[model samples]
Target: MVAKLRPYRRPAIILAITAIGAAAIFLGRPAIAEAAAVDGETEFVLNTFAFLIWGALVMWMCAGFTMLESGSVRTKNASMICLKNIGIYSIAGLAYFVIGYNLMYVDVVGDFIGSFNLL
Candidate 1:
């Protein structure tokens, strides 16, 4: 019976992973809704949460790109490509937080950009 069941294991594992991912997203919905409800001074919390979620999504995309690149590239270049992608994400995130964010939101002399609040 165990030998007979082995061939179907891959599908079962995929289904299990899919179900777990779905459950996690479903559980997170309520927290997102609650964060959205906050207003005024509490709005910053919501905004921060939104940014964090966006960053997480970007990180996820980076992971996918890393996987695709590693798979498509030659064996000799696979490690280098993966490392380059990782470095790009690291530098981009750091630069965005340290300089780009400030430049975009701070030192603005016109209405087109935001002011330096550092909230």
Candidate 2:
């Protein structure tokens, strides 16, 4: 029995050593609260960065939708779908460039509406 089990001993010892090392590393690491002490300005910057990333991803979703729709539709209608998607996104971009940015950022003291000035 001993001779039969001798071949597995080396592999078992290696696995045990690896597990102990992993455990030590995990135990020695700092807690999340201690490592994530973001200041107010840093928090603001992070928030702005997150918004930019979210906006970019949202804009790119139009292309993704176009691809998905064109691929799922018939060959005869795929071109039409792609064109429609492109046109819609172009108009949306123009509108946002012209008015959306101003509306979002400019100081308007109204409770429900913003100024019409170009921002």
* Tens digit per residue, CA lDDT, model 2, 11-101: 9999999999999998799987688788988887888799899989997887899899999999999999999998988898899888887
Model 1 lDDT per residue over 2-112, tens place:
999999999999999999999998976767666655566587776778888997998898899899999998999999998999899889978787767876646667745
> How does each model score on lDDT?
0.82, 0.86
Tell me which residue pairs clash in candidate 2: none
Which 10 consecutive residues of model 1 have the lowest summed lDDT?
110-119
Error of 1 at 54 (Å): 1.7
lDDT (0-100) at residue 5 of candidate 1?
Answer: 98
